[model samples]
Target chain A: MDAAVTAAFDLRSWSAAHLDRVESALSRWVVAEAPAGLGDAMRYAVLDGGKRLRPLLVLAGAEAVGGNVQAALRAACAVELIHAYSLVHDDMPCMDNDVLRRGKPTVHVQFGQARALLAGDALQALAFELLAPDDEGIPAGVQARLVRLLARAAGHEGMAGGQAIDLASVGLALTEDQLRHMHRLKTGALLQGSVLMGAACGSADAQAQDALRRYGAAVGLAFQVVDDILDVIADSATLGKTAGKDAQQDKPTYVSLLGLDRSRAYAGELLAQALDALAASGLRDTRALDALARMVVDRDN
Target chain B: MDAAVTAAFDLRSWSAAHLDRVESALSRWVVAEAPAGLGDAMRYAVLDGGKRLRPLLVLAGAEAVGGNVQAALRAACAVELIHAYSLVHDDMPCMDNDVLRRGKPTVHVQFGQARALLAGDALQALAFELLAPDDEGIPAGVQARLVRLLARAAGHEGMAGGQAIDLASVGLALTEDQLRHMHRLKTGALLQGSVLMGAACGSADAQAQDALRRYGAAVGLAFQVVDDILDVIADSATLGKTAGKDAQQDKPTYVSLLGLDRSRAYAGELLAQALDALAASGLRDTRALDALARMVVDRDN
Candidate 1:
């Protein structure tokens, strides 16, 4: 097989293994059951099927810096847990009130909003716990940076801030800048953190970190734009979840502001920019990243 | 001064210094801006007045093990941040819906529910970031243990689970065992974690850790019992917040089940148990821990 083809297969296999490792670690860590009921709610929320994109970014970023992908797995898992928590809370009746996620009923829908809220809260706390360095993982400073990055991304200026803006912007005709601002905080923060943290875990230098960050930002925005496009174009059956909920709610979206074609075009442009940033970094191991970026835009769900 | 008295005074002084350090570190760290709006909300929630009990536990525990109080401050601050976040969310309109906390408006009332929720979420993430071993303070294993302990305490089986049970138990009379179970998850998890993490940070052995945990659980229950008693006896102004809200909400309390006098007596017994645990630990630095146990029952706010 060609090197590119081999690399593609390797990436898929590696990503799957990384995800499995994360799942196993979570199982080992969360044992003990008077709490059995609480565990059920959390498992329902986290085990719902999805692409697991954030963790892929962490592993790929780590690999790009010549670090062991396995070593970065806990941080990757931590990021995913944080993401899952956000989804559970966002689906609460008082928040976005989402009823379905990844083809299954949302946490709030399945477990009730109060439990869902607590599950999210606990998951968020658990994410930090996961990131606390173990004896065999990446170095302490790198671990600290990863924790800091994930925290900031998950925090107010990042996901939560984005959520606040989203809540506030409902029924309001947000400007393009306002819409972008919300996306950056909500989706972009963790997306960027995922890649940067992965790279930092691998001990990437300042220049490399900057390049990875730019790459992350571009792809993060691109990911959302693609999501907007899919929301408009894909059917619920194909998407494996309810589509057009955003429009039904009259929440502002990239497609709403830019139209379908423009949004798709914007996603492409961002992908190109992300790829260009990756290229400029002059790193040899970013092939996985490049493929991941392309896959992001091309994904239908 | 006698050794015990001197130690008690030292702990008081050290706690103040530790709090100051946490405040300064947090101020210094949140310099970046895209998330600026949420950042402000986060700072507002964290900076508000509270007892600072969890952080003090971390500092005292570390000091007990002969660790530098300053080194443990970041971890201490992180736990406090998580606690603050929980309080913020617990008071939301969709949750407990309380209006007053520490004699001031709750975060949701002051900043709006959406902002408060985001702030709480962000703060939780920030807490982990604070603990992730950076810049010559604590070791990675200690940091890891801290993160794991705090996470487990905050998650489904701990504080969040406790909240779930509390919500479920409303309007329904619960047995004392059930009530104790609820308190253990809701309040004791974090309390036990606070002392354990502090001792671990100071490099306490497993035996010491277990003893501290026992001390923590006793004091933790005592703390809640005292709060319940005060709710009946203390005025809103003296309490620095509303005192009758719990009864008004008809939430389960030791006082409701056991009456005020029994609750007070139970609290005293718990305090004695905590002091006894401290003595059993055989540490040279039991003075601070002893004072803390006494303070838990006597505290008015």
Candidate 2:
């Protein structure tokens, strides 16, 4: 295999181990020994398969700054939980009303809307709980920073704001700037958090954190652009979920606005920008960062 | 007016002033000079009329312990923002589907579901942001504690968990214990946070915090039970929003499970328990706590 593919597979293995650790910690903190049903929905929401890209960025960011991945793992899980909660709630009847997620019935479809909503709310709370553990090894200030960042990213100016823009632009064809603004808040912000959180892991210098943030923004938008491209080319079997749903929903996408060819070009440009940011940070280990940039567009999923 | 009534009204006014200050600060922090429209939806969500009861409790809890109310104000406003967010999301089409709230169309009704959802999410983030202001004088550990407490109350075992139970038991007949569990999770959790936060406001002893927590828990349930009763007895005009909708939906309620008279008695019992907890704390200036406990069931909204 080429170095790129080898790195992708290697990073996949590396990120999976960290993710498993995160998932285990989450299960311990959230699930009680009894009342299995209440926790069942939580598990269902968390365990649903995804790329684990955000968590990987967090670990990578931390590792780049000589911090242990283990220290940052809880935050990794917390961000994922926030992301999962968003999806569950977003699929509700009043929202996107999606039935299939990851090729399975959505949480609301299986657990009912009320439970789904509650599950989402609970998950959001769990994110914070995970960040502010009873053990105070992490500095209180850092924990507080984590709380503030995650909350803002998950809330208005970031993900929620993006979703608001998306919702408002449903029928209308939004301008390129408008679409970018929406995507930046919705997807870019969380991805940025993943990186910023990693920088936060072991007192990484502020300059490094700032550089990684730029990298995160570039990668996040590139990830979305690739997604829009894949929706047209990839089949549901390879994608492991519904494909072309964006087009069907008439949701404005990079491909719809910029066309597929230009969108792919944009992804490449963003990947370069991300790498440039990492280089600017004066980081020596580019292995994980390099792998992530390649994986953003190259993966079938 | 009775002394209790007079005190409650005075508190209502005083709390409003504090809330206005907090709201103004929040607007300054979150909104920008440009993008007036983007910030407008969020500003509306925060500025909309509601009794700032949660913030009042935080201030009350602080004053009860002889702490500076100004020091506790940020945390108070943060909790209230979270509460407001929950209300916005809860009234969306996927959840309660209510059109009116606080005598106005619900966020979703006014801004559409997507914006409403986003607004709710944003507000949640803003609450956390408010908790950890950079130049603020509160200790970092205390702020971290506040964030953790609020997170737990809002998350799985508190408000969200309560919401899950409520969603699960919509048509089913729940036992009295199950009903209490729901209310405790949903409403009791935040209420408990209010008291704990208040106790944390100054340098109250742990014992005092614990006593106030018990007081909070008791009063939380009392408050919800009163809400259940009011829904049964009060008209929409009096309540300022939809009334009798809970029963119409056939959702489980305290009154439904225990009957109206029994529910009222239970509320009284809870109020007494709250008072006992407050008294056990040995607070000298029990005026705020006393007024708050009385106000739990006395007011219309």
Candidate 3:
């Protein structure tokens, strides 16, 4: 194929194939075995879910570094579990209080509040458990690295910290920088951690690691920017979550601060930066990473 | 001193000294560095008070095996963090809904519900982060093993699952076997995991490991049996929590299943089994373990 033709390579087939693997891995790992209702709630939160963007990022990063597929698969599923648990907790009455998510009732809405709380807690533990399985296929060093990255990304300094900021910032005007910082920790940390974890699966030289980190940062910010835009532009049916939630909650967002037009332009700039980092990565096969960046910027939801 | 005099060594000084170390490690590790309210909430949930039995068990287990003190300290604090987070979440309005814990307002009662929820979530993540720090003082293999042990003990098949069963069986009558199974997973698993995690910090032969596991299981269940007895007999002020909560919530307990006398006897039996296993381990310096096992059964609160 010509260069232009290859540049326009179809991501649909790639996503479909990888999504199948991600779903199967998630299903096998997230079992409804014990604790009866709690396991069911965990499975409900994680399985048959929203877009598997974090897992895709992980797999794509692994491919870029020629990493181990088994480790990448585990990393991918682990990140998704963290994401799913966050969503479950965030939608509780004490938090965002949303009734709908991914076109279905939230875990709390479906399972009641206490069960939802336990389910989220269990899911978080399961993520770490999956990362550090007793199996010999994944090296102890890799397991340790993955746990370190994921734990930091999910902990007080990362996603949970961001959520706290978001909670405290409700009805308060935030500067563009403050908003960016909040999103960077809340959503950006885990997204970046996913890329690093994927890279950790095998080996990446310093240059490649640095480039991947840059790509991850750009893509992570772009994701939140686009999400803010989608909350404004898309309907709840299309978004698979309550639309315009930020505005309704009086929470500051990208569109709220930068305006819709500027937010769109900012996402475009981030997409370009992400692609630039990929180009500098000195890796031959980062097509998927490039494609995922575009998808993040262009997706309606 | 005579052997009898040495055997009757005071546990207070020993516990006091080790508790000082555990507190310092926790204070150093669980910082209020960023995200504003989150650090405060996490600190509030973890610091100040609790029996710190899990951390003591970890230290004692490590000492018995001639394990690394640094690794054991980290594991000790990590288990305590998990225990603290679980209590924070369990005390929320949606769960047990108690307002008092450790002689003060619960996390949700002091911090708002949302912040309390986030704090608990962040604390759980922090537990894993402590287990897998970037420092090289703890080996990668040990880190992986610790993460695996903690995760399983805390996840659905263990602590969370036990909570689920407890929630579901609130009004239902449970058989002695069923109740034993529930307590084994809920409280017993993490206590057992603490001993195992401490042992993982150093070398333990198969025979020693098996004996420690048995000892851990016995002490873990005995702790709960004694807890149930205390709930019936102790006052809230003495317990530092709302006493008789299990009965108030109409939850089943050992005292309810077997009469108070039989329940007390069962606790004694379990304590005896724990000491027997420790003796079989062929480890000379298990003075702390022996003392801790006795403390679990004899403590008033």
Clashing pairs in 1: A157-B35
Query: Which tens-of-lDDT digit does each residue in A1-301 have in candidate 1?
Result: 2365343346577767777876777666544352536677777777636788998898888878877565578778888888988888877776777787888888878877667777788778767766764666456666666676887788766887788788778888988899888998889989998998788777677778889989999999889889888888999878877899889999999999999988988999999999989878866588778888988999988
lDDT of 2 by residue, B1-301 (tens): 2354343346566656777776676567556321214456666666756777787788788877777555587877788878888888788776788988788887777777766666676777777777765676677777778888888888777777777667667788988888888888889989888878877767777677778888899989998999999999999988878999888989889988889999989988998998888778867666677778889878877
lDDT of 2 at B173: 90
Residue pairs whose backbone atoms clash in candidate 2: A156-B122, B158-B185
My TM-score estimates for the predictions, one after another, are 0.88, 0.91, 0.97
Q: Against the unseen true structure, what C-alpha lDDT does each candidate score? A: 0.79, 0.78, 0.92
Could you say which candidate leads in DockQ?
A: 3
**In model 1, how many backbone clashes occur?**
1
* A165-276 per-residue lDDT for model 3 (tens digits): 9999999999999999999999999999999999999899999999999999999999999999999999999999999898999999999999999999999999999999
On a 0 to 100 scale, what is the lDDT of residue B222 in model 1? 85
Please give the lDDT score at residue A298 for candidate 2. Answer: 81
- Residue B39 deviation, candidate 2, in Å? 4.5
2 or 3: which has the higher DockQ? 3
Evaluate every candidate with DockQ and list the scores.
Answer: 0.52, 0.49, 0.87
- Sort by lDDT, best first: what order? 3, 1, 2
